[model samples]
Target: MRKRARQESAFLNIPYDRRYESLYLAFIASLCAFGLRPRATIEIPSTKRRLERIIELIQGCRYSFHDLSRVQLDRNSPTTPRFNMPFELGLAVDWALGANPEHGWFVFESRAHRPEKSLSDLNGTDPHVHDGTAHGVLRGLTNALTRKIHDPNLAELDSIYRDLSKAARKIKESRDGSLFEARPFQDLAVLARQLAEERISSLRS
Candidate 1:
């Protein structure tokens, strides 16, 4: 059962900040639209051995999506840039390259040419450019994944995303209005899976 779930899971590697909330929810909805469960490190406790836990999460998922849209420096006092997303992406790369050949990985960016300039390591690879919008994320996902039996329509995907956004907002409101927290994130994922199932079901009917 666990192995089956893992086969259906996708390690969601996106920034969990306020600025990326819409795109965050968009990713959850898009991945779920094609029947892939989205998992993240948020489920892990903020204790020791977090890095190892992240690697474990990546290993459990058959697919991994890395979003490098938060490319600018954060608004902290030190104003340092974030490396966690890219670092985990590296781990996913290592998993696909050396550890598990079945593990699939993808990169996403807001700007069309940013990943090539910012992360030259992915020179030959092309990151799905979302143009920093929820609609773009849906289109990007359509380009990224496909299901032979249940290929999702872009219009239906957008509908799912819109519905998920509404549910996510309510879930966050009940949880101190924080969209990126552990509990709310889990709720959001559950709701997204449900909503995607419904939307896709109607597509077949």
Candidate 2:
């Protein structure tokens, strides 16, 4: 008589430092739904190992879903501090999916083959436009998808864009929206310099 866990609540209730609560919860549900009643009760660490191996394979480009072992649903372990496999595998997946440089296994389909463009393209008449719509869109999409899907490498961008988009949307919905002139080039220049000097120097190694 095991009651089903609410997906969103289960997702949020996992420990803060533990990253892959999203994936683990989903995996547990999937296992239970498949009738593995006895297996789903196991601790996160055991299941985490399998996910880690799969991510490693993905990172090395040598793995597929078929390569992993099926986790039993009814297996329960009394392990505490829960496994961080989901978070770790998520990082590997993020690495596999690329970060600042586009070299990940999972690439976005949105800009697969399109030529990069500037903001002026949308408003050719604006001689002082700094067209950064492309960068903005790409940044937003990458952040949202990666964070929501548990891809770790690109997770920071989520809060960055969440704040950026919130401001942008608020401005857009205002009566003086037309006063929002594009300064994309200036923003890009600042971003480039910030990335090269300030940000790059701060990386973990």
Residue 1 accuracy (lDDT) in model 1:
88
lDDT winner among the candidates?
1
lDDT of 1 by residue, 1-205 (tens): 8789888899999998787899998998888778887889888887748988998899999999999988788888899888998999999999899968988899999999888878999999989999989988999999988767568889988888899888887787788878887788788878887887777874334
Cα lDDT tens digits, model 2, 66-96, are 1011111323565343334334434444563
In model 1, which range of ten residues has the least summed lDDT? 196-205
The positional error of residue 175 in candidate 2, measured at the CA in angstroms, is: 7.6
lDDT of 1: 0.87
